[model samples]
Target: MTILYMLLSSLEITDISEQELELIEPLESKFPIDKIKVTVCCQSSFICFRFYVLSSRYKWMTYKEAATARTAIGCGLIHHGILKGSCIALYFINRPEWLIVDHACAVYSLISVPLYDTLGPDAVKYIINHADLKAVFCMPLTLNSLLSILSEIPSLRLIVVVGGMENEVPLLPSSTSVQVVTYSQLLSQGRSNLHPFCQPKPDDVATVCYTSGTTGTPKGVVLTHGNLIANASGFTISVKFNLSDVYISNLPLAHIFERFDHISLAHFGVAVGFYQGDTMKLIDDFADKETPSKGVFCKSNFKHVCRAEYI
Candidate 1:
């Protein structure tokens, strides 16, 4: 059967065998699937997101905690009627909750479709309608933009707001049929009603990333679990990463480059830090006086760097 399957493909690699292909697994292969707490037994925090309102502060989560959150969020998604294999949209800036929700989708075999704010409302509406997203996990800033187009997205049933709602939930149109819930509320519901994990095959679609629409209407690029793992593997071969290394996630998560970077870095158990939403303060974040630096910076197209003292 494997020989026949390989022969049917357009390209053939005589050196590679069917057994090698079968060995390919999802991101969980590097990370673990079961015993989430024990597998990522790192006591130190693995992910942190900064908040700068009046002062600078960071919210940290250990790998164990992140794994737990992902599981709960995945179960919560199921409880909210977002079945496995459904397409969910992630509309937000770079943040910890974004990764949490994305990891949840990965664990449950749901296809995550990322929506960038720079894409504008028209493009966002087009992608939402085009992908037929079942649900959207967005921050409070992007909530209004999504709500404005609620009438257009027929497939969207749930709106899981990441941050707590600062103001009262906006009154929805009488004709709309969407339910809004806070991130914490969803987590609580999921905790009470835990669902079994639905593992995905290598060939299963992991995400459907959209083009920037600079030339024309955005087009969705379907990527499978195998494709992602392969991309990460290739990246690691080119760039070495260490478990003690820290990665600052200032790039937009919606971009495929940044997405692949995150996957590869996480595979190496590298800690990740998210900058405050404001781009103007990005330099300030790098020059944080409270945190010491090792004076080593890796220059990249995206300016990937980390403060060694953060770890």
Candidate 2:
């Protein structure tokens, strides 16, 4: 017999236990935990793409800053009449803004739907129409793709470009009634008129992740708040994480695995650094010697894996 079957046979258990099927409490309950003094860790924790800003140095947002931003963004959405349970699309590569918007969704009980680059234009169009998304948060690199498909998605009302200046955005056709705004503009409006948080229950839907459509048409999978919490809790138990640990997030956040990784690591106050949007330079980011901090504590070269070290 195979080693896996042999191991299973050695176990005395016949059926899965009740505890195994039970869901854990939401992580939001532990908001601003005493031990998690700082959420995103250091100033150089979240590095932006070199193309966006000519600086080689990185920047970060502390948990407090992140929480404030998320609250503002959530209020901004509400100000725009995007009520709770409304579906918002996240169409961009991994970045700090992505996480900020995601947290906004969780806090305000809005549903987040991720769009993957690997899904191409056709699949993306399909997913947008299928989900009936009204607003999409994108970056300069992904804006063109989204704009290209705008005429086809009538339900789309607003386009918030993250990390992009107003002038950089291409002029939309006069016929299209869709509005486009910068991320800063949204935050500004939100700060002016804040809205109360519309917290979600554990059974509420958190996200609807679409598949790659490799088989044919892309299919969206619904995930609840309880589902994410349970998965993140299980991950926390499997690995011993330290508060000083830093996780390098290089995987696409559109995928559930990467999403879970972010949630799990952040639960323990682990600092997460996003890749510089260039896979080739990822190694350089890991071995970056010019960081304002001292020498690196450790290194791991695995793909889509977190490298724990002190910076």
Please give, for residues 1-311, the per-residue lDDT of candidate 1 as tens digits. Answer: 01001111211223333543332233323332211111223344566444444235544566656656777788898998998789998887766777778888887789999988577889988998899888998877778888888888888899988775535556666677898888988899887887656766668888999988998999999998777866666666667666567677767888999998877666556677665556686677678675522222222221323444333
TM-score, cand. 1 vs. native = 0.78
Candidate 2, which segments miss by more than 4 Å at Cα? 1-58, 170-175, 278-280, 292-311
Clashing pairs in 1: none
Count of backbone clashes for each model?
0, 0
Q: Give stretches of model 1 more than 4 Å off.
A: 1-40, 49-59, 171-175, 277-281, 292-311
Best of the candidates, lDDT: 1
Best candidate (score: TM-score): 1
Q: What does the lDDT read for residue 293 in candidate 2?
A: 29
The C-alpha RMSD of each candidate to the native structure, in angstroms, is 10.1, 11.6
Query: Local error of candidate 2 at 185, Å?
Result: 1.2
lDDT of 2 by residue, 1-311 (tens): 11111111122233433332121123323332222222323222322222213444333355545556776898888888888888999987766678878888887788899988566888888888999888999877778888888889988888899877878877777899777888999999887777666656667788999887889999999998777766765666667666556777777899999998877765555567665556787777767554432111111121122233433
